[model samples]
Target: MIKVLIVDDDFPVRMFLNKIIDWNKHGYELVGEAIDGREALEKIEKFKPHIVITDISMPSMNGIELIKNIREKKYGCKTIVLSCYDDFAYVKEALKHGANEYCLKNQLNDKILLKTLKETKNLIEKERVENGQYESMKDLANKCLKTLRQQFFREIINGSWKEKKDIREKIKELKLGDDLKNKIIMILEIDGFHKLKFGPHMRNRQILYNSIMNISKEILNDFNDGYVYRVTDKQFLILYSVHGEKSQLNMYKGMKEFAVRVQKNIQIYLNINMSIGISEPIYSLDRIDEYFNQCKMSLKSKFYMGDHKIILYKDIVKEISTDPIKISNREEKELIFYLRNCQYEKINYYIDLYVTGFKERNVKIEYVHNFFRRIILIINKVADEYDINPKDIYGEDTNPFRVIENMETIFDLIIWIKRNIEIVTGKLRPNDQNKFEHEVICEVIRYINCNYMKDITLVKVAEHVHMNMSYLSHLFKQQTKNNFVDYLKDVRIEKAKELMETHNKKISEIAELVGIRDRRYFSKLFKEKVGKSPAQYKKTIG
Candidate 1:
């Protein structure tokens, strides 16, 4: 809506102007009214109206002085003068002070008022289009400058800006200030574009994005006073200027409103939702990229946070503790083993158990974030060991963190890990593994099925088959889909179950028969797999 404010000293005149016009029907909203130019300035600052209709002369400040003040403050508002005086000087002076139209109080009618409002609307739209649209080489260059601005910002953020001298020159050329002032970065992206009604197609997406951006700029114009850039097809970057004495919380409130406004507008007009990630206020022009990355990282908080609102980096820090964490060497080895053998389900189980452990210990959320990153790093390392490049698995320019960021569940993470491992294993050894290894694995599986109650080990099996332990270990996972110890446990657990049902043996006696030395440890593994203890399993049997 184009906000319109009216200012006139005569109460009847203000009422007459308002009652005579169907503002909404003509695409204008009457935001407020002021009795004089002095009051109008206050309203103008508060409402940030698009069109101001005011009397030429009034108490304290007059229309001419109001216009000058508006110009000094850089308000892009179209003003219209309404006056009792039809003097030539008053008309020329109002026109000279940036009034688009002058409607004399005596001559004013519905027809003239409507015509003036329409003309003002046409002028505003034309000016906006001229500022934005590409009609020629000059227009195109102007548009490219916006794109170039984003490119330079990306270069600076990505640490490519070479020298401080060059930085200052470019900032001067772009009219960017040299002083280090507090600035906040926000990254907003349409939450679920594919699910939106008019998405996927380039043309439709562009129209939707442009409409949302324009609406967002209109809402934030008075508050943020910053440049907005299209950093990615789905994401937009906003460089927010921090003004005097605004607390960080107030900034967040304003940005939260900005997000809520965008969401309301997009949903109302385009039927879409957006997620905004806001960075903490920081100083210096060069650290834009760092702030941007912080916002990007916070954007991933949406996976844990859900969608359709604003999330602050400061709050994200508060939500996730800053406690340092380190993954055990054993955990990395196990994850790599799963990735190597294509045992995706086990990989998932390992991750689930580890996370459950964290919850039990009350570990911080940042650990959860770091945990996934470490897992991905482990996957990359294993791929490297196999002489496999990750791009072949994950695709070029693939941000594994981003891929995981949107994951809503452990099951989703499992699916992602599974797919990545399958891709790498496909490229590394697409066909079935070595034939001798397959033969060795089959022999081991048969041996385990026959003598699961015996004290069994990978070495025992490898020696029984007269094979190298390492090669046999590799083959055992390839053919039977289990590492030696896991497969042995599986066999022993099944055998123990049979002993429990038919033999009526004590739990410890059954544990002994399964080649498990510790009955307590056997029950722990049993509960993990069967969801019941050996005694509990035996009690259910008739």
Candidate 2:
């Protein structure tokens, strides 16, 4: 099928273009709909459509820039410009930039659109047949194309080819196309990738890299113009034309879904974790490097924001309250009480409450760092007063005092403090071995109860408890008289039952919120465990 991309700033215009023709019947596939030229550029590269129908005037990357960018990428596709009668000047400019034809918007009709599409199809088919003549040197041509593509991505994204002539020459030589403008640039870094001491079975870096790319492509298949390119050994840049989300809120929600899918797939398939820093949608091909830098700045949020999150540049708003975050004496004394008594859960609650309060206000980063640093210092003070060496708990090299000084986020600080608390608690009060083991099992159950809605697994829980997988499993089974998996499922099933009884959500949504993505599997499991299907249980409760 002849691939076709529709680019227009007006939502209605884009829709009109889509409905103007029965594209499939005319040997065309509607690959994507982009709001502006910049987004159109990204779509062009991704879909590599035979024809691009674009509006002459649009925000961010306008039609003129789009045509120029398409030419620079050496994308040999017909560009049909949608223009107003008064936009004849822009229409002429678009043609000069390599737009193939102009369609007056006021005079737009199916006949005009179909004729252009048919002609573009014929041109693309002829070119394809002509290019087929190079079969004798296919391998040589493929090798050259691959090398060119690598060099171009490296040069363009890195800001080395800023000159128009140089960029144009490279695009022609490489036969590459770019439909990227003011698109959201996502910088994804595999957490602890370089630090990973992989065994022999995972030695092939290319295989691992390809696996990552495959996962990204599959998850982002809906993004027709999304381009995932390797930026660094540990990082990838995803230039995705942000569309379909509808509103700013939905855009963020979309990015979140994108991040979740990538993170979930990576953890499941590669046994690896990754963090993504997403920039606010940007325009201008020349500004890619700048946007990448913004993404880097966003990643810095991880230092304080924690990992496995999609940090949006826009959300990094700095509306700092003039008044500093000061903990009252009462609050300090309460925290001290929890720390002294080794009430780990209570400590976590206070920390979360404080963090949530500050975050809701959208305090400055410095204030967040100061807050966590002070909290850690307080912990250190406790250790000193009790004649306890924190080094004993958090290894000799990782002095919590020293780490907190450099730590960025409250989340990281909480992790450090909780881990040390566990170590110190076990040591300071190990006389009650039975009680300590019971506490460990209880913590495991608490964690499951809290995080069962997330993609939690035995391995994740084991890590959270800081115990060997086997050891955690044994303890869980001993304490609960049920396997860890069974306990987790029971918690989820119970929660699902509660939600069903309340009749607050659809059964499918309840299944998803309770961690099961497959509604059928959830139904079957619920019936097997509770002696009734979810629907039956809900009806009985009602």
Candidate 3:
């Protein structure tokens, strides 16, 4: 219900106005009445009415003065001015002071007053909707501006923003001036960003972006003037003005330490590898763009130097004189040859050589992934030519071609690739010598199903098959198209799911029956495979 207040110096007028209108029927309630505008203000504060119907000629404060005060106080109430005369001047003044309705005292009636009140309420609601829309638009504009700033920073640091006039215009737009003389740029990239799966349900992009922005904000809070922007989807640009005491290098080092601390403290935290680019101190605003490019070059150095803690513009320039050699096709083939042989030590040696070579030549991480992808394609082609199943070679849980951790040695990668290839291709040929391999696989599967409640391992399965553990794993995948561990887990999960659906078994009992002693691990595995917990699955069946 809408609350209303009536203010008129004449007691008879207030009483008549109150009685003439059926306020309750019209979805309104008369909360209070005051003889003067000053008294009306007091009642307004107490009642917090939605509508105020007041006389224009009141002592202490009139309708126009009261409306002015309400507007100043930002009260979202509708005001209707009551006047003895239909004077154009009084109506205009009341309207200008945020009054929503104007009524002449002589012409006052229930119909006129009701119609005026209804119209005022409609107008009030409309304004509220429009105000909400304005706020939404304002928020969107701020987000767009932030994105634009990040883009500008990226372009400037990369030396793409070369035009003086363009730089000036951007500076004017961002309102950054000579005051930001001690500006420092920090380029932060999420480690294993490409490995992260982004799908309809997985909002990885937004999560990473928000995390980086939040961290940047925390780091720059102590600095008086600083701004953080998403330079790219993967990288963030933090622009901060260091106080006179701290050098650019010192500030960059501090930010690196802060980033490390944050990563350690936050669970599921991004292993953020940052490349800080420190520009020379600029006294003039015109050189801001130039320094930005310098910082970008510094960041680019990370591609060659690997995950760098800090890179300065001066260091990039110093190393610019010599160009490093690119990895040759012959070298790549040689590395693959070593990998195919399972020469783990040799593979490490070559990988180290390749990484060192790339560092000397300044190859970026993006290029490295591309190069590795090409190598994986080649390995796949080789496997196909040899009639080898690629999945059998790589196993189920691990990617043979993936570069794990900071293994910069090409030799180590080569050995990993070879071992995976051998695993897949070793079983491509028929078991001419071992005629009992298929029977062994069948018996193993039967044993796992029957004794799933007991602790089982590859060794037990191998012993039951009267073969070595490694050979049994190879034969299992070759025959069943899955790894031993994965197949075992799947069998256990399926049995648990069946019990949950057909039998009235508790979750703990089901987990124990599946050889899963840890209830939490059982639940996690159940949810991952079945898309719900054991209890949830039972509820659905019921």
Q: Highest lDDT: give the candidate number.
A: 2
Winner on lDDT (2 vs 3): 2
| Cα distance off (Å), candidate 1, residue 534 | 36
Error of 1 at 122 (Å): 27
Q: Give the least accurate 10-residue stretch of model 2, judged by summed lDDT.
A: 427-436
Give the per-residue lDDT of model 3 (tens digit) for 1-542. Answer: 88999999999999998899799999999999998878888888999999999888788998888888888887778999888664668878999989888888889899999899999889878887999999999999987876776677778755787789888888889766753666655555543355556777547678868886786687567544667777766667666666564565776566556545544433235544444565655566777776766766776565445443366676674444234344578977875675455444564456556656655655554555555566567567666866756654554575644553333333334334444443433333234225444777766765675456679999987887799898888888898889988988998898687657544445876788678999999999999998998878888888
Error of 2 at 58 (Å): 59
- The sequence of per-residue lDDT tens digits that candidate 1 reaches over residues 344-383 is 5577567767766654454555566678888889878888
Q: What C-alpha lDDT does candidate 3 achieve relative to the native structure? A: 0.69
TM-score of 1: 0.39
Off by over 4 Å in 3: 1-3, 9-19, 29-35, 39-50, 72-76, 85-100, 129-162, 170-183, 199-207, 210-228, 240-285, 288-295, 298-542
RMSD of each: 16.5, 19.5, 12.5
Q: How many clashes in each candidate?
A: 0, 9, 15
- Comparison by TM-score, 2 against 3, better one: 3
Once fitted onto the true fold, the runs of candidate 1 whose alpha carbons sit more than 4 angstroms away are 1-141, 157-159, 162-165, 178-183, 192-201, 222-224, 244-249, 267-273, 300-309, 318-350, 356-542
User: Each candidate: what lDDT?
Assistant: 0.73, 0.74, 0.69
Ranking by lDDT: 2, 1, 3
| Residue 289 alpha-carbon offset, candidate 2, angstroms | 4.9
